[model samples]
Target: MRTRPIGPYGTAVSVIGQGTWQLERADRRTAVRALNTGIDAGMTHIDTAESYGGGAVEQLVGEAVRHRRHEVFLASKVRAANASAHGTVAACDRSLRRVGTDHLDLYLLHWPGGHPLEETLAGLRALHRAGKILHYGVSNFHDRHLAELFARTGPDEIVCDQVLHHLGDCSAELRVAPACLARGIAVVGYSPFGLGSFPPSPRAAAVLDSVARTHGATRHQIALAFLVREPHSFAIPKTATPSRAEENAAAAEITLSDEDIARIAAVCPVPADDGTPSSASGRRP
Candidate 1:
């Protein structure tokens, strides 16, 4: 898998990262196998959250990668309600203990909430000062929130912003994408396959089918290819099956033509409002 520089942390992550959302529910053997498969496939990044399985997922990830921690970039998030400095500091320590790591490559605020943004950012800054986290970012933030964060915290302090982005969900394109592009902050796209809702339209499916036929790839590979094709973009798709994990990692090599990209973009309409799905409501994982 090809790797990209995430930010000032100098951590190089795979283009296709693994998302550990439902990993805790999988039997320990299955979880270990899937994670090991991902790592062997050159997937150097693993995204998990403290809220996932109420901390079980982090524990599982910690165990799976303990021996190979240097080969992977580990990232996690603190819950939205726990945005305060105290809460964030405590959460960071808990994540470290669960992951069996001394420091996280990247730490994120899972979601924006009622807490003062400055206070939340200050908490992350404190963690950075203490050498608990290498970099800090946000998830599920809109353009306004990003701007607020940039203004108060300054541009260099924020590393990246993660959001739900797929062929079917282009809400980030309106403001978030452009803003990030201009500011030099990488955009981490989660659920790049539209959460399994692929083939954006009949037209898109037709185009991808032809492309896949020529490249000997699956439709899912074509979908993920569309995401990484974007500059400074990274994708993390969750999967428990080893085969699916391999397929997702293979997407890194499936390059698309300009015509194919245009055709897919045409069928997948960019939403006037933010493309975040209404069903996206859930705890971070």
Candidate 2:
């Protein structure tokens, strides 16, 4: 798999990672096999969340990585509701237990929430100091939220900003991505295929088809390749079967040419933002 520096820590992580958002919908044994398959394919970055399947998926991930944990860069998120100074720590503890790990490679606040950002930071900082988590970041935070965060912390203090970025939704590219890129932060694109809503426009479908043909790849693989084309960007496209996992992992090997990227850009321009959250996946837990 291709690799990129995840944060200021300069940790090299797989450009294409495994996302376990709804793995519970699959049979437990199958889900575990899929994760292992992706890992074996060099997708060493595994992301899970406490909110996903009410923590069942985390346990599933735990079972998958139990023996090969050292080979994986595991990450998990604390729900916004549990992002307070106390709640963040408590939630991480439970997540650690569920994942059967002593420490997380990365931890994140699910999104901006009612709690003061400082409280969330305090908890994350505490975790870092105590060696509970090696790095921390935020998901679904916009440029404005990032500015506020940078006020209290250095740009490097936060490693990445996970957001909704795909062929159709380039809202993050409008501001969030530039802001992060300026600060040497990684832009981790979740739901890179737009939550199974790929080709948000007819023109996009044509562009993807043409590009896929040029590379002898599927449109889905092309979409994943597009998201990680940039040096500072990473993608975590989820799958529940070993076949799909291998297919997703293969995206890291397909490099889009300049003409391919330009064509995609012309056909799927960033849509005008309606002042809504970048993610189509609801932010609230």
Candidate 3:
């Protein structure tokens, strides 16, 4: 898998990282198998959150990587409700315990909350100084939210913004992703398949299928590879099947031609016209 840097001195994470949202509901053996299979396929970045299955998913991730922690760039998020300095520290400590790791490669604010942004930044700064987390980021943040958060924090303090981005849904491309890229912040795209909830329109499917055929890849890989085409972009596609996990990891190697990328981008859904309404509605903390 191709890798990209999260920070100047930070490790470069696989462009096709593993997303573990709602995986706690999956059978234990199946979940563990999917995660390990991803690792075996050279996917080193694993993302989870304390709120996932109320930490059950974190536990599963812990068990999967306990023996190979050094090979993985583990990441997790603190719910906005727990964004206070005290709560952030304690929450991270618990996450470390659950994930069987000494520290997280990246820690994110799941989303902006009723809590003051100052409180959240303070907690993230404290975590950085304490070395509990190497880098801090945000997920599901719009342009306004990123502007608000970066105003109080360093321009480069944010390592990335994890947003919903794919060929079928490209809200991040318009504002959220450009804002992050301009500031040297990586954009970690989640739901490359729209969480597998929205099936593509025939027009979009045909385009994806054409690209997939050209590259000998699946539609899922084509979708993911397009997102990771930029040096600072990453993709995390979730699945409970080991074969699917392996396939997602291989997407990093499928480089899209400029024309191919342009074609895919042209067919990508825009917020207002996307048949799937409520493009970024789910995954709220």
Q: Write the per-residue lDDT of candidate 1 for residues 78-182, one digit (tens) a residue.
A: 997787878899999999999999999899999887488878888899999999988889888876687677788765777788888888787776678778777
Q: List the residue pairs that clash in candidate 2.
A: none
**Candidate 3 per-residue lDDT over residues 73-142, each given as its tens digit:** 9999998888787888888999999988889999998878747888878888898998989998888888
- Name every residue pair that clashes in candidate 3: none
Which candidate, 1 or 2, has the higher TM-score? 2
Off by over 4 Å in 1: 8-10, 273-285
Candidate 1 global lDDT = 0.83
Best by lDDT: 2
Q: How close is candidate 2 to the true structure, as a TM-score?
A: 0.95
Clash number for candidate 1: 1
- By TM-score, the best candidate is 2
lDDT by residue (141-169, candidate 2, tens digit) is 88668888888888679999988788877
Better of 1 and 2 by lDDT: 2
